[model samples]
Target: MATIVETAVSAGSFTTLVAAVGAAGLVDTLNGEGPFTVFAPTDEAFAALPEGTVEGLLADIPTLTSILTFHVVPGAVHAADLTDGLKAATVNGAELTFDLTDGVKVNGATVVTADIVCDNGVIHVIDAVLLP
Candidate 1:
């Protein structure tokens, strides 16, 4: 099985997210031994942002890091662990509330794909980028 980074890279759909994680200097961190639950946003999700938003974020490492980390919750939380109204604290020190109604939602984004198992963690694809 691949690590979170490898799984995401192999998928090809998370190109922008992978790039942002690299740009944030979090490649090593995410590769580290972890049971992290990453709420990964797809390239389409990133593109959905307003004009130049991604560029602006990429230029700000600290802000980018915060945004990226906000998508990660420590421990390997699978889709089954997420019940309606469950809230988890993110690695960035923010909280994400899950709404099971009409599909799973993390903060303002909906989970498009879930339970992407990685060697060290799990990835749940989201349709929108979650901000802290």
Candidate 2:
């Protein structure tokens, strides 16, 4: 199977996310061997942000990287493994709470697509972008 980067690129809906990752210089890292759990936001999610938000973030590497890292957890966590009221710490050092009781909520974003396998990790597509 493809690596995280390749899978994300092929997914087609993560254009903004992929661009942000490249801008943040995190492409190589995500492509590396890692058991990462990524809460991936679709291009629509990025569009939900205010005007200029994406451009501004792209210009600010540190901020962009932090935002990107907030979507990633240290290990691969599949949907079936998630329990109600589970909280996982992200690569950004922030804790993302999950509410599996009603659908699945990571922080405030719902998991729209779960268990997307990648060579280095798993990707769970979310409707909204998560902030740290």
The lDDT values for all models are 0.93, 0.93
Per-prediction TM-score to the true structure, in the order listed: 0.98, 0.98
Model 1 residue runs over 4 Å out of place are: none
Q: For residues 81-132, what per-residue lDDT tens digits would candidate 1 score against the true structure?
A: 8899998999999899999988889897989889999989999999999989
Clashing pairs in 1: none
Error (Å) of candidate 2 at residue 30 is 0.3
- For residue 131, what is the lDDT in candidate 1? 87
| Residue 16 in model 2: lDDT | 96
**Residue 43 displacement in candidate 1 (angstroms):** 0.4
lDDT of 2 at 98: 93
Q: How high is the lDDT of residue 5 in model 1?
A: 96
- Weakest 10 consecutive residues of candidate 1 by summed lDDT: 101-110
Model 1 residue 90 lDDT score: 95
Residue-level lDDT of model 2, residues 1-132, one tens digit each, is 998889999989999999999998899999999989899999999999999999999999999999999999998999999988888899989999999877999998999999999899999999999989
User: What lDDT, from 0 to 1, does candidate 1 have?
Assistant: 0.93
Candidate 2: TM-score? 0.98
